[model samples]
Target chain A: MQNEKMMLEIQQKVELIERAAQAGTGIVEIGSFVHPKAVPQMADTDEVARRIKRYPGVEYRVLVVNKKGLERAGAAGIMKAKLTVSASNSHSLSNLKRTPEEVIKGFGECADYAVAHGIELSGAISTAFGCPFEGMVPLEQVMKVVSCFREMGVKELSLSDTTGMANPRQVYDYCLGVREQFPDVTWNLHFHNTRGMGLANVLAGMMAGIKRYDASFAGLGGCPYAPGATGNIATEDLVHMCHEMGIETGCDLDQSIAIGRDVQKLIGDDRGSFILKAGKCSDVVCS
Target chain B: MQNEKMMLEIQQKVELIERAAQAGTGIVEIGSFVHPKAVPQMADTDEVARRIKRYPGVEYRVLVVNKKGLERAGAAGIMKAKLTVSASNSHSLSNLKRTPEEVIKGFGECADYAVAHGIELSGAISTAFGCPFEGMVPLEQVMKVVSCFREMGVKELSLSDTTGMANPRQVYDYCLGVREQFPDVTWNLHFHNTRGMGLANVLAGMMAGIKRYDASFAGLGGCPYAPGATGNIATEDLVHMCHEMGIETGCDLDQSIAIGRDVQKLIGDDRGSFILKAGKCSDVVCS
Candidate 1:
């Protein structure tokens, strides 16, 4: 029964990837290459990666926790990977069983492997906004990890509001600071809607000239450390906001809403999205 | 029994007004001075206004739908009133039994009353952003109403997203246009959370240099015409966001939260606010 469930999950993930590609998603984070014993949800990530058909011009990325995880990703044929370390020391200790400094050293080795194997690596600083155990994350702590990525020649860098404790002003100020410090790096924002400021933070980031953002279908992902928190910002909601703002995200809003419905059915819940409940602004005609 | 319930409601509204004043709210819309037969929800406006103790320096404004409503407000000793009419012709006819043109002509008499009685009068353009009956509301239509108010010497003006169909870009552009046209007016923004863009629209308005906003306590108010729509943005949530952004809304956050809790208890539901569920971002400590 367990084997059957794993296979089914893998197949479902592959279908999700295909749907995501069809919806014009340029990049998709398939799964984390963490220890299966620790994160059982991602146990079939390797099989999913091996079995999934890749769309042309679309990049598939997996999360690498350490050098061992990077090696596993390499073995599983993941040409692109997201290398992340928690900016909060408490989060690092709890989630990775290592100090933030220790994770940075391990990331050095992982970055070296990426360079050696010609793998595209994007460095992400988790808990960049706040931490459940650490309260407000100072910019210096986040920049420490950012500087490491900068030193590693990581051109693509992401800042994750891991617990979604970000406000618009904070996002605007942080994005401005990052742009000033690392003008050459491509900045990506990863937000969760745990506190319901996800889309607002995205708007702030856009005002600060950030065009790339990370969202999940049906807002399906959540932090294991933060209980009662909602998942990532719904991709359909993000796309809806963008389309309404006249910003062409190249994603079909109708198609995205359909996928959100499918994901809601697959998960057997519809509590994740606002656009799914309130349709598009243009959907209701005043007859 | 109906009279007893009306008295109870009047008492509750009076208490709510006092609490809002204590929460550092400078302006509170007390009630609408409409005909009791038309809007029974506001039937006891005269009694509520008479019984409620006025907070020093806090302006208690009532809405006046017509010249008769203005006279009733004057009789009730309401020193401040919001004179408003629907921007959409269909909404105007349905809600007020008048065309948009007739409402504007009647507002001329209401404005004259304010000037004669030395009462502070602000004008609100209802459905300035979008109308459910008219779909996308043209800016020209809104400006026509604005022009009428401008001609009537109404300097304190507000634009209301009555159906909550506004996007950030649209808000920014419209506000810029309004500011350019009515450079000297004190502009206020009223947003609804019906589509979950309320806070985002507030941010946009703030970026456009708008300092005044309208939020209902516990998000208690909704458009009578738009069924299934959420209420106005919660006061505590608005205060929480402003405080987080370093903007002084003069509201006590903890006090506001307590009031929100009281309101939740009073209303017997907790579906109105995000802050009521998540608490403030600074509520958690890193220890």
Candidate 2:
């Protein structure tokens, strides 16, 4: 799908992207409010968010770091925003430069701002299950943050393993704990394959009745602070699993690979995914 | 704990290994049936199976390629033996010179041999979720294989998405389908992270009620045919997840890492985990 001559390729890409967005998979995260200096590729997230047109069935979301990030995201036409607040204050200071309480306060600010402007907010707690800096994140601490967000009127939640440090057993118990305490919040999983347990954690979370997992294209772009991991679970990989098991993700692996391949071409060797190295699981050979 | 001589200090390692194995939440995969020429690392499996004294409760299993492999394995002195039959003929032919049917026939032979010898057999349908070359394996085909194995009087079953090509949905539905069709067979999971969805697939599978899983230390051994994916989920990473969620794995992370690190020193950098690069998630500095 690459055009070397650049002859109206922008229009073609736009069309391809339009179709992808319209395919309707519930929620598709496009970008996050990451520091440009830390991740230059993601620095274009604002522009990427702006260029993406919303279709009827798809919910476009972006990750925001702070109140200012929320403002920038809103201006970029982001209808749904997910904010990060780490349970491990150590991880929070390293990643977000704020303590968990300060992050909770920031979420309160974002909720007030979003309500005033008619924007929807979903609170994403990074390292909810475990922290890279903190060996084991106690269930009580995770409960503290979830309760704070619930009190702040942020009803939607996204629990993240941020570092891919969670296992299936922990995922089940952790998610069950959260779901029992905050029965109304809709939460998804945010896992990285840092330690190669991303999908296993997803299974653990799902067993606890949590649906909607987050992944990146070709397993690209994990947190800068969480060094050594490659990416979130690849988008095509997730879709392939769902399709095989009869879950309704509403995504096409071929189409998603096409999307990821395009981005990979742009990123060059910085992105890592074995599927791209080999091709899709459903790929065929012909003479 | 290495000494001045730079070899694995055995006594310390044994104590650590024993403590970790005693934890009970971990599974040790003891063998692989790939031809010795192809996967030489697996050649020492018998020695590995014999040298390691098993604790009272933890499960110890060895891998078998075919009936011939089972015979060699039988002399190795293991309580349990695992078997594999690839779903794709091309891969089977290339890797073992046998079609899926022939491999299953081998499984039947091995089953009889195991029964006669009073050895427990755990059947692993390798490349079960999808094949590296063939692509898009039919569920009916997988079901047929399962039924065949069941009829052959196999006791336990392991469904391997060896290529890391499986998704949560596929894992969930596939496990559900197997559970419904063969409620008596207790199933385990063997996932690769070629596409970064190994752990996610585990999550989906767990939701479907399968608990036991198989993984290597530090994500060892990538399938040469699956294009981009590597081998099983890392044992240390998997243990980290389990311990984090308060799920009891009979292994410890520090101990597992020591093993992974030791193996890495032996292999000297080709296959290992990135978490080893960035260090542990708990390495964070709290404010």
What are the Cα lDDT values of the candidates?
A: 0.81, 0.69
- Mind giving the per-residue lDDT tens digits that candidate 1 earns over A1-287? 11112233778888888888888988888887888876787878888889888888888899877778788788888899998888999988887789888888877788889889888889888889888787878888888888888888889999998877888999999999989988999999999876657878999999899999998877777677654445788899889889888999978888888888887777776555878887777775456
Superposed by TM-score, candidate 1 places the C-alpha of residue A59 at a distance from the truth, in angstroms, of: 1.3
DockQ of 2: 0.37
What does the lDDT come to for candidate 2? 0.69
Provide DockQ values for all models, in the order shown: 0.53, 0.37
User: What's model 1's lDDT at A67?
Assistant: 76
- Which candidate ranks first by DockQ, i.e. highest? 1
lDDT at A70, model 1: 80
Cα TM-score of candidate 2: 0.73
* Candidate with best lDDT: 1
